[model samples]
Target: MYELKTKENDSSVIEFIEAVENPKKREDAYKLLDIFTETSGYPAKMWGPSIIGFGKYHYKYPTGHEGDAPLVGFSPRKAKISLYFATGDTKREELLQNLGKHTSGKACVYINKIADIDVDVVKALITQSIEFLKETYPDQPE
Candidate 1:
């Protein structure tokens, strides 16, 4: 279990967003903040060191690993924004096709800039990812 150090609260989110030095990156971060808040209908909170997360879920795996994590979140790295989503679901491939310029790992989407991707497509991806996590981790609390 990855223990989140930051409390789930508004001050944390504000402080984290304020730390972004680049104006363009800061603006992108704010845009993401809006998208996540609206999509999840959950207040934004800071998760750990840098993740701006929305909502919460309690997850327990078959191997006995269990903990709470945000339903959706992103970290604005120096080079790109790392967007996280639950992996191992097949349905997300369709959304990826329309996400514009992005790279993917097992469960992360890397966007160099918000302008590089279609905002609507990214929003849909967030929605689908949240749904996928809920379905796969059914015991998780919304």
Candidate 2:
């Protein structure tokens, strides 16, 4: 099992957001933090070295690869923001069409700035993603 570090020392989520060299990116990150916290009603925490994770879940594959992961989260990368949605089943593609300007991988949505997207639509996406995860992994992370 991969355990997250204690939220006691070095690089707090606020501090990490503040350290973003780009003022715009820093602001956008904070805005995202607000949206995530408000919509999910889950506290945000720093995961690993850089990801700002929201809620959590544990998954087990048929191959027996099991581990905990965030329900929804994002990392402020150098060039773009990487949003994570563990459940990217068929619905994800439909959501993407209405998400404004952005690209996505299997479970990550990449955006240059939040301004380029509709906050409401993003919120809906997050809401739907969380519901999907909860339904799919009912006995997830404790």
Candidate 3:
């Protein structure tokens, strides 16, 4: 059985944000905390050591691998802030097109700062990701 390293923990999100070395990143982390919480309508929870996640859903693959993951989340890294959204969602790709300055990987969108991208787009992404996850994983906890 494979073990998941990034499971949610009881760590304080505020302490994690305060520990961020960069002042601007720390500030932006607070801003994002507000955005994600308000948009997702779920309180922020610490995922692993760095990720601030919202609601969670349990997922199992065809191969029998399964795990619970946040519906939406973000991390204020040294180089850029990484926004976590559902992968393989075409609607996510469409929203990223209008997200302004940002680079994306399989499931994470990297942005230099909050001001560099449109906040409304980020909100939309959060909403879409949650809706998509709930629809995809109908067994998710309420």
Candidate order by decreasing lDDT? 3, 2, 1
Q: What lDDT does each candidate get? A: 0.82, 0.84, 0.94
Where in model 2 is the C-alpha error above 4 Å?
A: 1-11
Among all candidates shown, the one with the greatest lDDT: 3
Query: Model 3: which residue pairs collide?
Result: none
In terms of lDDT, the poorest run of 10 residues in model 1 is 1-10
* Ranking 1 against 2 by TM-score, winner: 2
Q: What pairs collide in candidate 2?
A: none
Tens-place lDDT digits, model 1, residues 54-129: 8777778788777777878898988889997767777688888888999999868999999899988878877887
TM-score of predicted structure 1: 0.88
Question: How would you encode candidate 3's per-residue C-alpha lDDT over 9-38 as one tens digit per residue?
Answer: 999999999999999999999999999999
Q: Which stretches of candidate 3 lie over 4 Å from their true place?
A: none
Question: Alpha-carbon error at 59 in model 3, in Å?
Answer: 0.4
Q: How well does candidate 2 score on lDDT at residue 18?
A: 88
